[model samples]
Target: MLTRILPPPGPARMLIFITMVMSLGQGLWIAINAIYAVTVIRLTPGQLGVSLGITAALVLISSVPLGHLVDRAGPRTIQLWSFLSLAPLTGVLLFVQGFWSYLLVTSVQGLAYRAGNNARKAMIAARVPAGDRARIRAVIRAALNVALAVGACLAGLTLAWGERVGYQSAILLTALCFLVTGLLTLKEAPVPPVPAAAGAAFAVFRDVPFLLFTAVDGLLSTHGLLLDIVLPLWIIHHTDAPRWMSAVLLLINTAFVVAFQVRAARGTDELKSASWASLQGGGCVAAACLLFAMTGGAGLFMACVLLTVGALVHALGEIRHAAGSWTITYDLAPDHAQGQYQGAYKMGVDIGKMFAPALFAWLVIGHGATGWIVLAVSYAVLGAAVPAVVARGARSRATAKVAAGGVTSSTVRM
Candidate 1:
C-alpha cells in the first residue's frame, strides 16, 4: 500500500517535486481567491462568477492548440512559460483595483497556468509506464492535495495576520515557488518526445470511446469549476460565515485527496471497472450538491460540517474519476499520439470551466437553487449513464477487433 501510494524515484520523483512546488503556489492562490475577490476587489458574487467563467473559457480555447504545441515544441517549453510568467501576472494582482483590471490580470494568470498544467500532466502521463500510470497519477493528485492542505493551514494564519498583507505576501510566495519549479522543470531532460505530425489538434477525436469519455469529463470539470467558484462566493455573500471558513472548506476538499485518492483509483486498468468508478465518484459529487441545496440557513458550524462530509465524498469520486480516466486515456492513446490525447483531455476539462460558473451564477441569482438543482440532477443522470456508455464502447471496440480477425462470434463472449 505504501509503495503504491508513493511514487518511485527517477523522472516520476522529479515530476512530483516540481508538481508539489507548482501546487503550493496554486494552493495559496486558491485558498485565498474567494476572500480576495470579495474583500479586496469588492467584486460581487456575480462578478466573481464571470471572472471564473472567462478564465475557463480561455483555458478551453487554449488547451487543444496548446497540446499540439507541446507535441511540436515539447512540454518543456510550456512548463518553462507556466513557471516564469506566473510571477508578474499574480504579483500585479496586488496593484489592481477595479473589476475590469482585476479580471484581466486574473484571466491572464489563469491562461498561463492552464498551459503549464496541461503540459505537465501530458508529460507525466507520457513518461510513466502503462501499468503504473494510475499509481503515478494518484501520487500527483495526492501531492497537490497535500500542498493544498499546507496552504489552507497557512492561509488561516495569513488572514489573521492582516488581509492585504496576508494576500500580497501569499501571492509573492506563490510566485517565488512557481519560479523555482519552472527553473527545475527547465533543468530536467524530456522523457517523452511527441512526433511532429502528431502535433495536429483534434487527433484524439478519432477514438470514439476516448471522445465519449471526454464528454463526461467535461461535465465533471464543470461541476468542479462551479464548486471552486460558486460555493465560497455564495457562502460569503449570502451567509454570515466567518472569513476563516474559506480555509475550513479548502481543508475539507483537499484532505480526502491526500488520504484516499490513490486508493480509490486502484484497479482502474479494467475499462468496465474504471467506468464504474467514474460513475461512483460522479454520483457522490452530485449527491453532495443536493445536500448543499437542501441545507438552508445553516450557520457556519453546521455548514462546515455538512460541506466537509460532502467534500470528502466528492473527493473520493474525483480520485476514482481521475484515476480511471488517466488509465483509459493512456490505454487508448497510440504511443506516438500521447500528447494529442492529453491535450484533448485538457480541452474536455476546460470546457466545463468555460461556461458552468456563469451559468450556475445566473441560475442561482435569476432563478434560485431550483436552477442549481436542475444542474445537479443532470449531473446525477450523467454520473449514472456515463459508465454504461464507456463500458459499451470499450466492449464494442474489443469485440470488433476480434471479429475482424475472426476470433470470436459474440462481442461479450470474446
Candidate 2:
C-alpha cells in the first residue's frame, strides 16, 4: 500500500513536489480568501460571485487555445508561465478595492492557474508512462489533500486574531509560494522537447467517440461537488440529519481520498479496466443516492448511519472516478496533440463545474428526495453504458488520426 501510494522517485516524483508546493499555496488561499475578501476588500457578495463567474468563463474560453499553444510550444513552457504569471497576479490582490480590480487580478490569476493545470495534465501524459499515470496522479492528488489540510490548519491562526494583518500575510504567502514555485520550475523542472504538430485547433471536436468519452468524464468531475454542495443541502432540507453532518461528509471524503486514491487507481491501464472502474463508480454513486434518500424520516441514529454510508459510498465513487478518468485522459490522447486533447478533456470538467451545481439543485431542492431517485437512475444508466461507450472509444482511439478540425468517420461511434 505504501509503495503504491508513494510515488517512486523520478520526474513524476519531482513533479509531485512541484505540485505540493503549488497546492500548499492554493490551500492557504482557499482557507482565507473569502474572509479576506469580506474584510479587506470590502467587496459585496454580488461582486465576489460575478468575479468567480467571470473567472470560470475565462477558463472555459481559454482551455482549447491554451492546449493548442501547449502542443506547439510544450507543457513546460506553459507551466512556467502559469507559475510566473500568478506571482504578479497574486500581488495585485493588495491593490484591489472594488469589483473591477478584484476581477482583473483574480481573473488573471485564475486563468494562469487554469492554463498551468491544463498544461500540467499534458506534461504528465508526456513524462509518465500510461500505465503509471493514474498512480502518479493519485500521488499528486493525495499530496494536494495533505497540503490543503495543513494550509487550512495554519490559516486558522489568522482567523483567531489580526484580521487585516492575517489577510495580507496569507495573500503575501500565497504570492510568495507562486514566486518560489515559479523560480523552482525555471531552475529545476526539466523541459522535454515538444514534437512538431500540424493539425486543426478544433480537431478534437471531430472525434465523436472521444467527445462521448469526454462527456462521461465531465459528468464524472461533478462527483466532488456532490459532497461539497448537494450533500449539504440534502442533509439540511431533505434528511432529518443535522447540518453538521455536511462537515463530516467532507471529512470522510478527504480522508478516503488521501488514503485510498492510489489503491483505487490500480489496474486502470487498459480501456476495459478503466471502463469497468467507471461503471463501479457510477454504481457506487447510485447506491449512495438511495442511502441518502433513506436518511429522510429516519431516527437520529439511523439517519446518521445511513448518511455516513451514503457519503462513504460517494467517496469510493469519487476515487474510482478519478482513477478511471485520469486513465482515459492520458491513454486516449494522441502524443503529438496531447495539449489540445487535454484541453478538450478539461473542457468537459469545466462544463461540469459550470452546470452540475444548478442541475443537482434543481433535481433535489426543487423536486425533493425523489429527485435523488432521478439522479440515481440516470447515473446507473450512464454507468451501464460505460462498457459499450468505452468499446466504441477504443475503436476510435485505435483508428483515429486528428486532422485539421475533425476526425475520420471511422473514428465516430458506431
Candidate 3:
C-alpha cells in the first residue's frame, strides 16, 4: 500500500491522496454528524432523517446527468470544480439553523459530492489500465479505511471539546480538506486516450444486460450497509451479545479489509473471475449470517465468540466483493463514455442503498432468527447467479461486435 502510493503517477497519485483526504475528513462526520445536528442544530431525529432522505433522492436524480457532464467536460474539469465548490458548501453547515437551512445547504453539497465522486471514479478508471486497476483500487481503498480510522479518532477528540465548538471545528477542517484536495487535483494529467464519442451518452442505456449486472452487483455491495445498519440492530435485539460487540465487529471487518484488500484483488481483473470471486464473497457473508443467527440461544460469552467469528467471515466477504465490483465497474466501461457508463453504473449502488434499510429491516429485524436464514440463502443465490449474468452481458457485447465485424478482448462484460 505504501509502495503504491509513494511513487504513484503524478495525477492519479494526487487523486488517490484526494480520496484519502475526503475519507479522512468525512470520517469525522460519520458518527458525529447526527449528534451535531441533534445538539447544535437543534433538530429532531425525524427531521434529520427526512433531510438525509431528500439528499439521497437528489443524488440519485443527479448522478447520470453529472456523468454525462463528466464524459463531455472530462473528469479533470468536473473534479476540480466539484472539489473547489465543496469547500464553501461544507462550510455552509456552520450557519445551518433548522430544517430548511440544513436541507438547502446539504442538498447542494450532496450534488457536489455525487458529481465529484462520479468524476473521480471515471478519472481513476481512465488513468489506470485494465490489468492494474483492481489492485490499484484495492490499495487506495485500504488507505481510505486507515484514513477514516484516524479521522474517527480525531472526531472522538473533537467531541471531547463538547457540543458547539467541536462540531464547528470539525466542519471547518472538513471544508479545508476539500479545498486543499481541489487545489492539488488541478495538476492531474489527461486521461488515457480513447476514441472520441460520436453518439449520445445514453448509449449505455441500450446495454440492458450490463444494467442487470449492475443491479446484482449493487445488491452484493449492500454488505457494507448491512454492517452499518442491520448488524447493530440484530446484535442489540436478537442476539445475546452485548451492544459493545458491534464496535468490535466493525473493527474486525476494518482490520481484515485493510490487511487483505490488495491480496484479495488478485485473479479478479477479468469479468468471469471477478464474478466468481463475488460469488465466493457472498457465500462467506451468508455463512456469517447463519453464524450470527445461531447466537440467539447461546450464553453471553458464546454469543460474543459467535459474533466475532461471524464478523471475520463477513469481513472476508467484504474484501472479495469490493475487489470484484471495483474491477468490473471500471473494466466494463467504454473509454469514451466512461463518465456516463460509470455514472449509470452507480445507479445500481443508489438502488441498493435506498432499499437496504427497509428491506433488511423487514427480513431481519421484523422476522427474528429465521429472517437471517432467509437473508443468507437469498444473498448467496444472488451472488452465485452473477457469473451467468455477466456471461449474458458478454454474449450481448460479442453479438454486437460480430454484427459490426469488429473484435473485442476475451474478458466478460459484467
- Please list the C-alpha lDDT of all candidates, in the order they appear: 0.71, 0.80, 0.82
Which prediction has the highest lDDT against the true structure?
Answer: 3
The global Cα lDDT (0 to 1) of model 3 is 0.82
Give the backbone clash total of model 2: 0
lDDT of 1 at 140: 81
- By TM-score, the better pick of 2 and 3 is 3
Number of the top-ranking candidate, with TM-score as the measure = 3
**Clash count in backbone of candidate 3:** 0
lDDT of 3 at 143: 82
- Which pairs, if any, clash in model 3? none
The candidate with the higher lDDT, 1 or 3, is: 3
Error of 3 at 406 (Å): 4.2
Off by over 4 Å in 2: 1-4, 187-189, 193-196, 401-414
Lowest summed lDDT window (length 10), candidate 1: 405-414
Rank candidates, lDDT, best first: 3, 2, 1
TM, every model:
0.77, 0.92, 0.94
Q: Who is ahead in lDDT, 2 or 3?
A: 3
Residue ranges of candidate 1 with Cα displaced over 4 Å? 1-4, 33-55, 92-107, 163-166, 198-201, 205-208, 225-250, 286-311, 358-377, 391-414
Each candidate's number of clashing pairs is 1, 0, 0
TM-score: which is higher, 1 or 3? Answer: 3
Scored against the true structure, residue 28 in model 1 reaches a CA lDDT of: 79
Per-residue alpha-carbon lDDT of model 1 for 208-236, expressed as tens digits?
77788787767875766545776776666
Write model 3 residue lDDT over 1-414, tens digit each, in one string: 456444356655676688888888778777688888889999999999999999989988778888888877888888889989999988888888999999998889889887888888888877777887787788888888988988888898988878687788898988988888788787788654344555655788877887888889888888788778898998888877889888888888888888888899999989888888889989998998899889877999999999899899998988998888877776566667788778788888888999888988898888888888998997899889887887787787777667667777665544
